[model samples]
Target: MDLFNSAQGKNISFVRPAYFIIGGFIGMAHVKFYFVFLFFVYVVSVLGNTIVMLVIYLDHNLRTPKYIAVFNLAFVDLFGNSALVPKILDTFLFNHHSISYNDCLTYMFFCYTCLSMQALNLVALAYDRLVAILFPLHYMVKVTHRFMLTMICSFWAFIIIAVLIAVGLITRLSFCKSVLINSYFCDHGQVYRLACNDYFPNDMVSYMYPVFIFWLPLAFILISYLYICGTLAKVATVQEGLKAFKTCIGHLSLVAIYFIPLLIVFTLMEKIHPNARIINLSLTSIFPPMLNPIIYVLQTQEIKESVKRLLKMDRKLQLKRIAIM
Candidate 1:
């Protein structure tokens, strides 16, 4: 309390709390089952994303510019889930609801950063598909490994800075009122609204952050697909156009998985029950990481064949070792 009271400004003194209570899952019936499901989702997400990354790393055939985005997506998904799910379980399931002020901000930073990257990563994949489908002749020259790495790295740098700014704005707030954040995690909007001081900056960020992370990325992806469609229309035959478009199915599935639930929940947020909304939001956060690898492995022939070849090699080694025994 003494430490927080020392933060004095021109005229106004700030009242910062030592900790905030997370009551997102409190007083909800059958919440334990949701935690169990989350555990299952986390386990599968870890295994699936790990496999995808390992396959991409071990198979030289999978090291194309396209797979670079895929590899990064897997890494982001793994890191995102690792950042969110465990803390959620510990907070709600194990009854560790009180989060220190600094820890809550750190939690918010990682969760928001990873969540923002998920959207921007889709933009990277969309760019890869756009160039590959629209400009096949120049795809090699345009979408080199170095170019893809640069794009992904640029996204990382931009999003880290942006999220840091958002988190930084939260520090300017003075939570003199109730420190109970009503969300599942340390949500940005929930945390700032509890402040007694001027939170107009935080409120502005609440509006702008969604535009950068959600709307802009979705717009880019839609426009890219429109361009892809326009190009495919001039193909020699219907089958050729279909064949070209088939390559985008995995990416399309990913976009749908990532965006659709959030869209629905946000669109109907006022009408939905608070607990239901929280559950839906939690699902939106956790499901994509679990589903992304499955979609890619099943939809992309390259990844499927890589998995097959690796499995066959492993089986052969086992057979040889058994024969030796």
Candidate 2:
């Protein structure tokens, strides 16, 4: 990959940023087989997200605003993973590391933007649940189709604008320094660190998205869920309280799964150790897409059970109609 330096008459690389690849001077196969491990993880992710989307899309029981929100989450995860994982696999497996300026820009833009939007979606979903539970009488009106659509549009618009500004600054940068990315793919921090010019503006704009995308949403979600829990407590029925608590557990588990790794990955990138960087980064990008669906289904027994019941009903009706005919 240093050939780019000679061909373009510029230098870029950080003294073989593969410290974490084969174990970072540590004898762990986790670093040695990172590519194979990631391949299995990505396959499960694609299948899991695809199954959620397909089940939700084809099943009438899943057409509600709740699962539509989930469908959106799954779609975002699928696309974001698709954008990065394939390229990553290519790099690690086939030794195809060179990327065009435009390809790099597109990859970075979508992956980063989708992550922002996904976190926002979860935050919004938390609010949706609060509205559905605490103010049951007004759930339909509050989470109406038109309002959901508007929120979706607004969220995308705001996030895309933020990402565009960051990415635009990146494109204007002269990469007169190292081209080697210390991570698996084109991460914003790694790229921003490579620019040879004034990186103050870049730093100000670079990766500041986590504050907006993660911390803000995380705070909102935590508060909303707390409210949800408090309100659920006041209800008179034990069965009802238990049921609601079960649902909350599912959402909380998922919230932890999504946010914990995210915070860890961004924070750990500060370390000069490549092993910490690779492990954290890989889990942040890979695990959420793979595990989010399982959490959604397992946590909310009603949704998956509803899907199953609806399928059974359809099969019975079809058989009955055929017999009558």
Clashes by residue pair, model 2 = 12-177, 12-178, 12-179, 13-178, 13-179
Looking at model 1, report the run of 10 residues with the lowest lDDT sum: 1-10
Error of 1 at 244 (Å): 1.2
Q: Model 1: clashing residue pairs? A: none
* Candidate 2 wrong stretches, greater than 4 Å: 1-32, 235-238, 266-272, 310-325
Total colliding residue pairs, candidate 2: 5
List model 1 lDDT by residue over 232-253, tens digit each.
8876478998998999999999
lDDT of 1 at 129: 93
Q: Which stretches of candidate 1 lie over 4 Å from their true place?
A: 1-12, 322-325
**lDDT value, residue 157 of candidate 1:** 98
lDDT of 1: 0.93
